[model samples]
Target chain A: MQLRFLRVIFICLMSVAGMVSAAADLEINTPAITALKNSMQQRHNQLAPYYVSGAVGLTRDGQIVLRDANAVPLPQRQAVNALVGAENQDRSALYREIARANQHPEWESEIRSTFAGRWIEKAQPGWWVQDSQGGWKKK
Target chain B: MTKKSCIALAALLLAACVTINIYFPAAAAEKAADKIIDEVWQLKDGEAAGGKGDTGSTDDRPATKPGATK
Candidate 1:
């Protein structure tokens, strides 16, 4: 009788754990996330021209890259490189901040992948985006 | 074992097996990402029309966002 009772109890406990895992909320916001979003927003205007010219592309891992240095004028190449670096820094920080805000820093990679898909999906026409196979294509 | 002791042992076993299993919320994360992307890109579909209507007016734009302190 005790063995059967224990088995039933174990199954019930497992189901409860499953339910808890299923209901996690990702939209939980904090000041850190808000700040990161605003920072990225401000940088977007400066990066827009590079994106339009295919000089910068969104990578599959949720970061931007200077895909075609030749697309930028030689004189402005250094500035574009710096802008790409800054944009990438902010992107990674945003992913980390979101995971930290959710109290599960281990979820950083998942959060990044989610953002990667969104960034590519929302990319403007003629903007370059990396595919799952790491190839760039203009979209 | 006594009935009470058996119940205690079962409870202990159950507690040991009921480990915390927090899964990543992928769908929610995607939704959250979209919201942030929309803001970062300022991708209003009607932006051009709106801009033409409110030429030289900056009221719609938020006052300067504090730049990142790199």
Candidate 2:
């Protein structure tokens, strides 16, 4: 009987959390999520110059892409490509982490879609952003 | 009105609301995304990293966020 009661309590607690997660913003703050955010935040610095120069652009799928490969000199192109790869890996992890943190792993796609739109919406004026239709435009 | 009729009315109302919520919630997701961006980017000064400081190598977590909309 006691075990049954505890199970009921656990279910109720989870339902409450689910409701809260559904209604609110994605502020998980788990160590993994925080680390991912901080990592992205730090990497944003390295990527900032490229963004300003129109070399890299934010995609509609919450990842960055090389918008103008020729923008970077041939010698530095490899380094920029490496940075874009690393940023994308961290971005994928951040989306997955947010979904997992909310206990709804399936929400990852929606979260990523949300972030994609948000990233473009929040992009700087000169920064390139991909539209929902896969078209790139300066924001 | 009779209690039975009142209950029926409430049921209809609830069904309508629930259907709206179950319709994929694109608006809600966008609203939530905006709030997250505000917090994460911490857009200060003008835009994109404290106006004057696009300088890399610093934590860019924003200060506070507004409430989420449904």
Candidate 3:
């Protein structure tokens, strides 16, 4: 019985260590992540106006979407679409890269969701952001 | 039917359980996300500038840097 108890304690310690190591560092970065950040940063200049105009919004899934094409001038609508597409491509890639950097590619979706919240949380006032229930509201 | 063999089997099962139950670290991810966002948004002066190492975007945002008092 004492041996069985000791086995249980040993297993508990091993599991705790496993959990700690896996969660040990989400701040891990790599060259790929830096590249993604650079691309997104450059694109933010183009996307910021739409965000303020309510033509674009931060989605609850870590993506930006053209929330209202009518809000954009007709001639600029296509450009907005292109910007949103490129931004989302980089956003998804960033999440995947971060997960891969941590050697936990399977954590991509979790990272995406976490970023989804962070984006909205860090959004400027008067910018549109999506809520958890899929509704958009000005932040 | 040795006691040593039984303990070894138990250890293996526990190890497998640990591998299978790895969790997503939400708090750490949030911190990581913020670091990336601050860099991308270039939130240096006020919330206006958005980029890295650049002076600022071309848009007519206020020139105040973030955390700067009026």
Candidate 4:
């Protein structure tokens, strides 16, 4: 009878151990990921244009990853020129902002590409994004 | 199985599950890019610059940037 009890205890312990191991394997730091997501949202709000449409992406490590901006065709010459200038300036600022946030300039391009690729992949229908080879595609 | 073997199996499973691919809409991407630029311009200096709306592509003129290549 004691042996039966011992067998039951052993089986219970093994089952508990297996469950613990599986849980550990699937562990994801939810809070850390949430914090990172919040940071990305803040950064996007800061970097995004008020009038123009654009998207920003970040790497898994909370680094600025990719930025996609487009200049809509303008009827006014001044508006067109202004749009062009803004595009260049904003692009530069995006790079600077990412570098500043992560304190890792080297990872800027890599992070950008990672985010860009993801954004493109997840873009909704009728949304526009760029491809890996710098080609345009519809999502 | 040994702990080491278990770990090895887990790593193998992870490796097998890894997937990476690029997805973006050509037309949508162009429009998004254009919208971003326009918004930035407006925000930088508060002014409205009228432009040909993205809705009608009557000209069919291609984008100048290499990234905009269809």
The most accurate candidate by TM-score is 3
Chain B, model 1, TM-score against the native? Answer: 0.36
lDDT of 2 by residue, A2-31 (tens): 555455555555655565456555446588
Per-model chain A TM: 0.82, 0.84, 0.83, 0.37
Model 3 lDDT, full chain set: 0.83
Give model 4's docking category: incorrect
Model 1, A38-134: lDDT tens digits are: 7787788899999999999999999999999999999999999998998889899999998888778999999999999999999989999999999
- The RMSD of every model to the true structure, in order and in angstroms, is 9.8, 9.8, 5.7, 15.5
Assess each model's interface with DockQ, reporting 2 decimals per model: 0.27, 0.14, 0.36, 0.03
TM-score versus the correct structure, for each prediction? 0.70, 0.65, 0.73, 0.30
Give lDDT per model, in order: 0.80, 0.74, 0.83, 0.39
Model no. 3, DockQ: 0.36
CAPRI verdict (incorrect, acceptable, medium, high) for model 3: acceptable
Model 1 off-target regions past 4 Å?
A1-24, B1-21, B45-70
lDDT of 3 by residue, A34-124 (tens): 8889889888888889989999999999999999999999999998999999999999999999988887899999999999999999999
Stretches of candidate 2 above 4 Å error?
A1-22, B1-32, B39-42, B45-70
Clash count list over all predictions: 0, 0, 4, 26
Which rank order by lDDT, best down to worst? 3, 1, 2, 4
Please give, for residues B1-70, the per-residue lDDT of candidate 2 as tens digits: 4555555554565555444334444565676566556645655423344434346534555646686454
**lDDT of residue A102 for candidate 3:** 81
Query: Which pairs clash in model 1?
Result: none
Worst 10 residues of 2 chain B by lDDT: B44-53
